[model samples]
Target chain A: MSTQMLTYLFVGLSFALYVGIAIWSRASSTKDFYVAGGGVHPLVNGMATAADWMSAASFISMAGIISFIGRDGSVYLLGWTGGYVLLALLLAPYLRKFGRFTVPDFIGERYYSQTARIVAVICLIFVSFTYVAGQMRGVGIVFSRFLEVEVSTGVIIGMAVVFMYSVLGGMKGITYTQVAQYCVLIFAYMVPAIFISIMITDNPIPQLGFGSEVNDGSGLSVLQKLDGVLLDLGFSAYTEGSKSTIDVFAITAALMFGTAGLPHVLVRFFTVPKVSDARLSAGYALAFIAILYTTAPAVASFARLNLVDTVHNTAYADAPEWFGNWESTGLIAWQDKNNDGIMQYGAGAALSPIKPSFDGNTGVHGERLLSNQPTESTNEVYIDRDIMVLANPEIAGLPGWVIALVAAGGVAAALSTAAGLLLVISSAISHDLLKKTLLPKITEKQELLYARMAAAVAVCIAGLFGIYPPAFVAQVVAFAFGLAAASLFPALLLGIFSKRANKEGAIAGMLVGLVFTFTYIAYFKFVAPELNNTEHWLWGISPEGIGTIGMLLNFAIAISVSRVTAKPPQSVEELVDNIRIPSGAKAATEH
Target chain B: MNSDEHTKQASDVSQIDNQKNYWKANLKLLAKLLVVWFTVSFGCGIILADWLDQFSVFGFKLGFWFAQQGAIYVFVALIFVYARQMKLLDRQFGVGDENDADQESQS
Candidate 1:
């Protein structure tokens, strides 16, 4: 069968499975909609959480990012995984004991202020929308590539499928579907890794394969060979860091705290049966997540080495079909600047396209052969970072079925995360905003209707973003992490850990953190990008690392504010203590 | 009235004692686990990464391995350890399922 036929077969089968599961576990009430009726087993919830947490970024873009950036990419590897530690230890159990449906519900009741709840709802919406937009874009990219549809049409199809499951099943539907997604995605991710590892190093386990000697009989380890290849191409050593030490530390810290604070991931713990199960579920999620995280670097190393070997010094006329195929998608481009058919790619040429500058040779010269044309560089062959993972199987000459599986896996990862995020957005609007505050007298059935409607509306908006995303959307996604870390994490942690932290303090801390992180990112990323370098940075911290500093500011402000503010009411104090001791908890019910 | 006051005083003292001991144990456990978490992730992964890179374990630079894989493994282990420890603590403090509302309250 043709590759297109296989892709349709695999993608169609997965979609059928998801719809079937949604029908099997359709949610019946608000409780079911919010927390899967609080009946999910720990291991099952763990799998679902893994699927929900690992987005297209993890499945599709991570290895590609790592292959290019080298050791500096460890920020993503360490920062993303280490947050599970904080989640398991600091947040999951206590939140589960509180037995709430949404994150804003916790903040609303814990802080005893509707104003605080509204603030949280705003933060949750901003974070979830930014995140869901990226997921929708992933869905579009996979569909357009595999199913031969326009990117917008692909997004619409993806949004429709997600709408069917999420609106019908809510958290109940999303959970079981996510379990299935986790299986498909992990299988797809590992199969190519194993095959490539064997192809290069004669080892099946990618983790060990990454460290094993190359089959070329040079006695050099795979990483050593890869480093040599990269260095020859005028790139830094593949295993060495290019980022400054403090930036690495700050970005890692931001991601760690941000993952712990994301509302979508936090809400998953509420689906389990007990407080103890919440902690166990987090561990299980980490274990499941670790399987992919550990293998990604290996795959990255293999992909990088394979890619360099295949492309470098090869004649454009003799280049493989995958090159032309990707080139047609506009993901890979070539210029042949020096008029040589042989492509030269290196740090010197820089993958970014050169803008035609109009000044003289001393400044930004346009189309002028400057005196400093080092090494007769043609500067051809620019490849998009996003295409590396999707193109990996084809680059290695893997079978057609494996390529199809990758398409299915990318769809599954994006759909699952998008579903999880949309549910959070819907629940915040319907359950927290409408039922809890705006329309308290609304019945549970009405609230459920509102939740489904809200999800539909959110899907429409997310789909639109996917279709016509602002150029800044990708850059602003990281700010979502910073916002979560700076605003929500401090409030949630302080609410549980400190009995003296009053509503006044929590509110003040959240605003201060939010405003500080936002202004820093906005100024650096948008207003004055030229000034984003270390000379202009505060303490040499990039906007990406500014969240950690903001979090500290939150803690300091919260403590000081609470000292001067009135104490929390007696009942709120009791509530904090009750959340700590998880003995008398009950399943979440409609208000 | 006199008997009621005596009983109230006794229960209050014990309640305070339980709260104190429970919090103390919880704090100590969190401190120990956090130390391990921090040491592995930020310490070995970042601060000591250059130093540890000189040593290779199974062809991986030790620091690179920790940053990528080892820290995650330790994180998973730490959480399970914490869960097990917290469960025992809950049992010791008589705050496990013994005080839970009947199973019917659960879904």
Candidate 2:
């Protein structure tokens, strides 16, 4: 069978499986919809959480980004995973003991104010939407690349699949389907990595192969060879980072805090049966996630080495099949700056505009003619970082089946995360906004109907974002993490840890953190892109790292404000005391 | 009647004291574990990465390995340890899940 046939078969089978689970696990009550009846096994919830947490960015773009940036990429590796430590230690168990339907429920109840819940809802919407847009776009990219369909068609199909499961069976359906997705994505990720590892270093384990010597006659280790090659091409050593230490520190901290704060991830713990289950499941989730995280850097190094070996100084017509295949997808392009008819891969940007603007005509060597002016740099290739993982199998000459599996894996990663985010969005709207605040007297059946309706609308909006992606879709992702870290994380922490944190203090802290982080990011990213570098950044903290400072400010302000404000009521204090214990964590309740 | 009231008051005080002790112990455990977490991730992974990278183990740079791999392993271990210890703590304080139904009935 052709590669396309295999891709269709795998993707079709995955979709059918998801739809089947949705039908089998159709939510009968609000409890089933919201928290999967709050009886999910720890291991199952852990795998589902792994699937939800590893979005298209982790699955598709991370390794490629790491390959380009080298040691600086450790910031992402550490930042994304280290947050789980915070989650397991400080947040998950206590929240589970609270036994609420949504995060805002905790905020509303603990702070004893509707205003606080509204603020949390706003923050959740902002973060989830921004993050979901990326996932939707990822779905579109995978569909277009693998299925030979238009991006919009791909997005619509993805939205339909998500709608079928999430709207039908809610969290129960999403959870089981995500377990399947976790298996598909992890297997897809590992297969090519193992193949490449053996091909490059004679070691089957990508993790060990990363540190082992190159299989070729060169006596150099993989890292040493990578460092040498990158430096020879005028790039920084692959083992050394170019980012300033302070900037790296701040960015890592921001991401760590942000990861711990994300609503979709935190909500997963609520599905487990008990407080200890929450803690145990967080450990399992991280262990599952770490498998891919540890393998990514190794994959990055191997792909970089392979790319350079395969393409550098190679004749345009003789370039590997994967190069041209990706080129047609507009992710890879070439220009003959020296008219040498050979491709040059180097450090600097090949085109002045960074992204290639293809012209209608083909060049003398049949390369795509680009309207982009060639830069003074010797680099003559433009490779989109998102293609690294998807193109890896082809680059290494793996079987067509492996390539097809990668396509399915990418779709699974995107769809699973998208479904999780949409669920949170709908729950915030139906449970928090409508039932809790607006229509408190509504019946449970009415509320469930509204939840499904809200999910349907949210899925459509998400699909629209995928089809007509905003110009800032990529840039706004920083907003999601930044806002979550600066606002929700501090508020939740204070509400749990400090009983004196009244409504006034919690409200003030969230607004201050949200507004401050938003202004800083917008100023640097939109207002003055030229001044976004270290010299102009406040205290050597880039906009990406400003969330760390924002988080600190939130902590300080909340603590001080609570000192001045009236102490929380006695009942609220009792609530805090209750959540601290491990027993009596019944199923998540509407009340 | 006076003696009965006094005994009930005494038990209430003891229960409060037990809860307080449990909280204190939980905090102490968290502090110790968090210190180790900080040492592995921020202290070694970031602050001391360059210094530690001066040494290599089995062709892997020590600090880089910590940043990329070792810290994640430690994080997983920490959570499991926390879960196990918290379970024991729950049992010790008579707040284990098995006692949940009993507590609910009394309430």
Candidate 3:
């Protein structure tokens, strides 16, 4: 069968499977909608959490980014996984014991103020919306590239599928669907990785393959070969990082805390049956996530080596089939800088505008004519980092079925995460904003109706973002992590660890963290893009890492304010004492 | 009546003391595990990465391996250890899940 037909088959089959699960496990009550009736097994919840955590960014973009950036990419590898430690140890079990339906529930009750709940809801919405937009765009990209459909049409289809499961079955549906997605995505990710590993180093396991010598007669290790080639091309050694140690440290810290604080991920813990289960599930989730995370670096190095070997100094007329395929998609481009037909892949930008602008005409060599002016640098190729994973199978000449599987995997990743985020957003709106605060007198059945309505509307908005992506969609991803780290993480941690953390202190801390982190990112990203370098960054921490400072400020302010303010009420103190123990969690969930 | 009140008060004090001791034990365990967590990730992975790169195992620099792979494996282990230890702690303090279910039924 043709690749397109297979892609359709795989994507169609996977979608049908997800929809089947949704129908089989339809939610009936508010509890089911909110936390899957809090009966999910630890292993099942772990799988779901893995799918929910690994978004399109992880599935599609991360390895590619690491391929281009080299060792500095360790920041993402360590930062993302390490945060699960904080979650499992510091947050998940205690929150499970608290037995709340939503994060805001804990903040609201622990601080003993409705105002704190509203604040948390706002933070939750901002973080979740910023994240969901990226997932939608990811879906559109995969559909447009693989399914041969328009980006808008792809986004609409994605939205419809998400709406079907999430609105109908809520968390219950999302959990089971995510398990299926985890299987599809992991298989998709590993198959190509293993194929490429053997092709490059004769080792079947990518993790070991990357550390082994190249299979070719040269006898150089993969990393050694990569470092030598990159250095020869005027790029830094693949094993060395260009970023300062402090910046790397700060960015890693921010992502770790941010991951733990993310409302969508934290809510998954509440679905499990017991406090111990929550801790165990977090471990399982990380183990599942680690399978991909450890393999990604191997893929990164292997893909980088393959790219340079296949394309560098090759005549344009003789370029590999995959080159022209990706070039037609505007993700890869080559220009004859020296009037030589040979391609040069080097360190700097190939064109002045960075992205190619097709001129609707073919050059003498039949390469697409670009309006972009050639830069003075030696580089003559522009490759979008996002295409590495998508183009990997083709680059290595893998089977067409593997290519089709990748397409399905990418969609599964985007949709699964999108569903999880939408569920949390809807629950936050219906559970926290409406039932808990604004319309406290609403019936349980009415609340369920509102949750579905909120999910439907949220899906539409998310789809719109995918169809008409904002210019800042790519830039604001940092804001999601930063804000989560600076605001919600500190507030949640303080609420659980310190009983004296009154509403006034918690509110003040969140505002300070949010405002400070937001302003820092905006100033660097928009107000003065030219000054967004290490020299201008505060304490040598880039805007991406400033969240670390913001988090510290939150901790300081909350602790000081709490000390100065009156102690929390006796009841609030008792609540803290109760959550500290593992018993009575079942009773706590009853309310 | 006086004797009965005194015995009830004594039992309440002992229960409170047990709760306090359980919390103390939990905190101590957390401190130890977190030290390992910090050492592996922030210590070996970041701060000492360059220094530790002088050593290599199977072509992977020691620090690079920790930064990319070792720290993550350790994180998974830490959580499991924490889960098991906390379970034992719950049992010791008579606060395990089964005990809670039993108490609820009696009430």
Candidate 4:
């Protein structure tokens, strides 16, 4: 079949599977809606968490970013996965033992303050909204490229599909659908990588192929060859990093803490049957995620190598099919600056500044060959990073079926994460704000109704964000992690670890952290983009890295304030002791 | 009622010891696991990466592999180990039962 037909078929079938799971597992009660009735097996919950956690950024853009940036991209790989360690060790089991339906439930009950819970809810909504916008845009991008529809239309379709499952089945449907998505996404990601690995290096495993000798009888390792090529083109060595070590450290720390605090991911643990299961499930989630994370570096290296070899010094007329294909999508472009017919792509001018070789000789179409060269020209080819993964199969000359699978995988990634984030947004509004605070007398059935309605509303807003994304939306998504790390993680950790931490301390600390991180990100990302450079950053800490300092500030302030504040009530102390023991975690329905 | 009280009084000493031992053991285990976590993720993965890159493992620079793959593998192992060890600790303290454990205020 043709590529378009295959993509439609695979994507259609996956959507059908998700909707089918939703119909089969539709929830009848709030317990089922919120925590899948708290009966999911540890391994199953793990797979679902993996799917929910690995959003479009991880599945679609991560390898592409790594491909271009090379060694500097390790921050993402290490930071994203390393946070699970913190989650499993410090947070998951204890929170699961607390047996709450949402994160705010824990904060409210633990701090014995509705205000604290509201503060947490605000943070959750902000972070989840920022994240879901990216997912919606991702879905739109995939649809526009693969399905040949407008971005706005794609987002509406996406919203309709998500509404079907999430409103009907809530966490239960989203969980099972994510498991299916995990399978689809991982299979799609690995197949092309394996084929390309074998084709280029005679190594079947992409991970090993990344380091193996090239098959061109050059006897040089793949990394060695890539480094030589990139360095010759005035770029840094591909195997080594060019980022400041402090910035790398700070960015990695921010991501790790952020991952640990993300409300949607933490909610997955609430679905499992036991506290022990939560711990084991986290390990399982990481194991599942590592399958793709480990392969990503290999994909990055292979894509970079393939791109550089295929395009360097090739005439525009002789350029390969995939190059032209991506160019039609407007993701890749070329301009013959010197009228040399061949396109140049490098760091441009700083290393090998162009000299005017033109003698005013005109050729066909009034184009002068080598005579009108710009004195300082360097770059000629413009390649978008987002295209690398999407165009990988085409670049490698893989069959139409594999190319179709990549489209399905990208959609699955975006939809799964969007579903997860939407659930968190809905739950925060319905469970935290309306039911818990405004209408405590509301029935369970009524609360569930509110949750569904909230979900629909959230999806519509998210679609709007996707269609008309603000200028800073993409950059703001990065700060969602920073905000979570700065605001929520500190409060959650201190609430559990320090029994002396009171409502005043928790609320004060969260507000200070949230405001501090937000002001920093806003100032740099929107208010003063020019001042965002390393020279102007505080201690060379970019806004992405500023969260680390914000987190530290939260810890210090919370501890000092708690020292002077009134101690928690005796019942709250008992609650803390109870969570620490973790021997009597109740059913989700017990709430 | 007198016999019940007597049994409760008798078990309190042993129960206190069990609880203390369990809590102590849990914290100790967490400390050890956390040290390893910090060592692999921050130590070998970042601070000591260049130094460790002097050696190669399975056709990968030791530090680069740690930054990308090794830390994640160790993190998975550590969590499972912690879970298994915590289970034993809970059972040892006779606190593993769902209903009988931490029932002080719930009833």
Candidate 5:
């Protein structure tokens, strides 16, 4: 088939599969809509959770990130996966036993205050929306590449698909569709890794590929060869670590705790049948996720070496058309800086597009090259991390269909996550803010209708914001994690575990946490940039690491406030005990 | 209120004690899990990553590996430990279901 036709074929089939699942799971009642009738098999729930958790950031950008940063990127590797451990051990089971539809529900019930729940709803919305903005952008980027559509047009198309499934079926539809998406994306992720691993190191398994001998026939292992190549290019060795130790520490910790705190992933545990299953399913999710996590570093190593070898120390004046094609999207670019028309790429490029300045020699004069100029590069190597996963098939000269499958996989990842977060956002709006707190008399069916409306409206707003994402995939995602880590996590942890955690204490902690984390991130990411003040940065921590400090403040404030305030109600303490032990709990009935 | 029900209630008190004991067991398991979590992540991975770097394994920095792949593998392993404890809890409490899903769904 023609590439265009084949691309549409794969994307269409995948979309059909998702919508088909959504149709099959139309959710007859509020219970079905919110938590998928709480009957999802542990394994299926695990698969859905994997898809829900991976998001576009994981499937598309993570390895790409690792490949570029070398040893410094280990922070991401540890932080992202380590958080799941926290989720499994600390949060998932108890929440399942709590029999709540949303995280805020638990907060409200535990604190015995509608006000506390509303505060949580606000925090949840801010965090989830910020996170979804990145995924929405991922959808646009992928669609533009595969479907040959404008990025804005792609965003609209993606919004429509998310609206159709997520709005109509809610969590019920999203769960099954996510299961299918998990299969497609993991397959798309692993296939190229396997092929390249075998090609480069004669190891069929990517995990072994990293430690095996490189094809260079130099009797050196892949790591040794990589270190040698990086040194030759004035870059750090592949295996040698260079990130500021403290920063790596803070970032990893923040992300780990953040994962445990994210509402969307935590809520997935509530969909399983029983508390024990919730605990077991969390393990299943991690085990499924670890497969990709384990393989990713090896894939990244292989790709980096292959990329360097392909573009550098070669006679090829031109890479294939895909490089230029993606470059026009402003994701990848090259400049000729030394009045040399040829492109040069490597360490000397000094990271980032040369501010379009490196090539004063190009269309504009006297502009210092901001990005790599292959013309100036002695060994060409201008690469972008976002391209790493997508370009895998092309890098290995795979067929067009495989490349098309990758594009579909990226969309699947973005859409699944967007749907999940949107559901949480919509639920917070209609369930917590509207029916529960604002209007106590709303009918169940009417509330469900409002949820559907919220999903559609949120999609449009999210789509608009997604079309103009303010940060890169990883950075924007960090903001979401930061907000969750600092705010809701503390309230939930304290409310159940500490009998003295009254509504006033919980509310105060959440407000302080939310304000401090958001203000810190906003001040740094947006406000500080506007002020142009490099001297004002405290501790050299970006908006990303600020969450750990914010989380501490939340915990401290909650504990201190509880020390001075009235204890939580006797009934509330009893409820916590009930949540702690399943104790013949009946099926949850959403009202 | 019946004589037989009252006798049953006396036995139920012992069951309540067993539940309390089970809760203690849960707490111990949590403590162990948290310690392992802290050691793998904060100890070898972060707080002492450099200190542990004084030791190396197969040219891999012991601390850095712990911070990265080692910690993650241990994390994956940690989930199973928690699951195993959950099963034991079920056996002691007579609540664990064996039809639960196995954790290996990786493609």
Candidate 6:
């Protein structure tokens, strides 16, 4: 069958499975709605959480980003996965013992203040929305490219599918669906890796394939050949530090802490029965996620080698239809600088033209990369990072069904994460903000109705954002680490560990961290244009890294202010003791 | 003699709940965690990266591999240690499960 037909078949079959599960496992009570009735096996919850955690960012954009940056990409591999370690160790079990349905509840009770709870809610909304926006956009990109639809239409369709399952079954549906998604996405990711590994290194395992001998009798490993080729092409050695080491280190830290603090991810721990289960679940989740995280570097290195080999020193620099195909999508762009009619890996300036060379002379080349794609012929490349996962099969010339499977997997990753994040936002709004705070008298049935309404509304808002995301925003993803690092990480780490963390301190910390980080991002990314591009951003720490600084300030100010304020009282102290002592944990705690 | 035994039992509960020593225990755990988090990330990736890059693993520089892969492996190991230690510490303070091997189910 044609790739298009196969894509439709795969997407349809996967969607059908989710809807079927949602129908079969519709949540009957608020407990089930929130934690799948707290009956999930630890390993099952771990698999679901892994699926929920790995987004389109990890599945698609990550390796592509790595292929471009080479060595710097390891920061992402480390940063994103490292957070899981922190989550498992520092937060997950304690919070699970706290026995709360939402992150805000723990914050509110831990700090003994309503305002603190509200602030955590705000932070949860901010981080989850920023994350959900990217997933929604991913859905659009996958649909438009493979299913032959408008990006906006794709977004709306994806939103509706998520709304149906999540509204009907809440965590119940989302957990099982994510398990399926984990299977689909992992299979989708690994098949191509195995194919490419076999084709290149004669080894089927990506982890070992990276270190094994080169297929050609070159007497050097594939990595060694890669280094030689990259350096020969004016690129830094493939594994050398090309990024500002400080920026790489700071960004990795921010991402790691942010991952640990993200509400939707930590909330998965509550789905298991016991604190010990929470700890064990985390180990299992990491193991499942490792299947892909460990394989990613190998995929990146191989893709970089394949891409360069295809285009470098060849008569057909862009003969592969892959280049033009992705170029039209506006992700990949090549400028014929010096009119050398070749692409080179060098310093950005040497390879860049100050003006567009697409009108064959005076027109723009990079901005609207798709519109003027060297129409009549010479090889000008413009492939996007998101294309890496999708194009992996094609780049290696795998079976057509394998390419279809990739498209399905990308959607699965995006949809699973979107469902998980959307549930957090909706629950926080309806269960925490509305029912608990605004209308405490609402019946359980009525609250369930509003929860469904909240999920639907969130889906609509997310769909809109996916369509017309703001200027200077490179798709809703660029904000993930920054927002999480700034607002959520400090509050979470402090609330549990520090006895002096009072209400005023927690609120002040969150507000200050959020405003400072947000404003800093706005200035560099969006505002500097109107303000004359000033060299004033406190050591050029872009919005992404600004969070690390903001988080530190949050810690300092929170404790400083707390020292001068009232301590949480004797009863609140008792509550803390109770939470830490698992044997005394109650199924329900009213006070 | 019975009255004397009752007084000793009361002292036992007080010792288990002693706020000062509990805080000290929590502090110890925090210090250990910070060391692990800091060493694996800052040490493996940045401060020692240059010197360590002199060594190579699987033809990849040591620092780069640590920055990318080794630190992550260490991080995974750290969590397992943290979990095991916390469980033990909880047991020492009478804060752990009364039944170690028993599992509970809810209706």
Query: How far out, in Å, is residue A568 in model 6?
Result: 1.5
DockQ of each: 0.58, 0.58, 0.66, 0.45, 0.31, 0.38
In order, what fnat does every candidate score?
0.71, 0.67, 0.76, 0.53, 0.39, 0.39
**Prediction 1 TM-score vs. true:** 0.94
* Each model's chain A TM-score: 0.95, 0.99, 0.99, 0.95, 0.93, 0.92
Which CAPRI quality tier does the interface of model 1 achieve?
medium
Error of 4 at B8 (Å): 6.6
Question: Lowest-scoring 10 consecutive residues by lDDT in candidate 1 chain A?
Answer: A357-366
TM-score of 2: 0.98
Q: TM-score of candidate 2 restricted to chain B?
A: 0.83
* A1-591 per-residue lDDT for model 4 (tens digits): 789999999999999998999899898888888889888999999999999999999998999999999888888998899899899989998899898899999999999999999999999999999999999989988898888889899889888889999999999989999999999999999999999999889999987888788899989888888889999888898768777888888989999999999999999999987777888899999999988998898898889888887777888777777776665455666657666888678865412123323344544433333432343647776677888888998888899999999999999999999999999899888999999899999999999999999998998999999999987787788788889999999989987788899999899999999999999988988888888899999889989988888899888888899899899999998788778776667633276
lDDT of 1 by residue, A118-183 (tens): 999998998898898888889988988788899999998888889899999999999999999999
Interface RMSD, model 6, angstroms: 3.1
Q: Over the true interface residues, superposed, what is the Cα RMSD of model 5?
A: 5.3
Top candidate, metric lDDT: 3
Docking class of 6: acceptable
True contacts kept of 2: 0.67
For model 2, how does the per-residue alpha-carbon lDDT over A1-591 read when each residue is reduced to its tens digit?
A: 999999999999989988898899999888899999888999999999999999999999999999999888998999899999999999999999999888998899999999999999999999999999999999988998899899999999999999999999899999999999999999999999999999999999999999999989899999999999999988999988888888889989999999999999999998988888899999999999999999999999999999888888999988887887777788999999998999988989999799887887888887889999999999999889888899999999999899999999999999999999999999999999999999999999999999999999999999999999999998887568778999999999888888889998899999999999989999999999999888898999988888998999988888889899899999999989888878778633436
Which residue pairs show backbone clashes in model 4? A358-A371
Q: Clashing residue pairs in candidate 1, if any?
A: none
State which candidate, 4 or 5, has the greater DockQ.
Answer: 4
lDDT by residue (tens digit), candidate 6, A247-288 = 776777778888888989998998887777787789888878
**What digit string (tens of lDDT, one per residue) describes model 6 on residues B56-91?**
887567787777667767766676676677677767
Clashing pairs in 6: A332-A382, A332-A383, A333-A382
What's the true lDDT of residue A507 in model 2? 91
Arranged by lDDT with the best first, the candidates are: 3, 2, 1, 4, 5, 6
| Candidate 3 chain A TM-score vs. reference chain A | 0.99
Q: RMSD in angstroms, candidate 1?
A: 4.6
Off by over 4 Å in 6: A315-318, A333-379, A472-476, A529-536, A589-591, B1-12, B18-30, B91-93, B98-107
TM-score, each model?
Answer: 0.94, 0.98, 0.98, 0.93, 0.91, 0.90
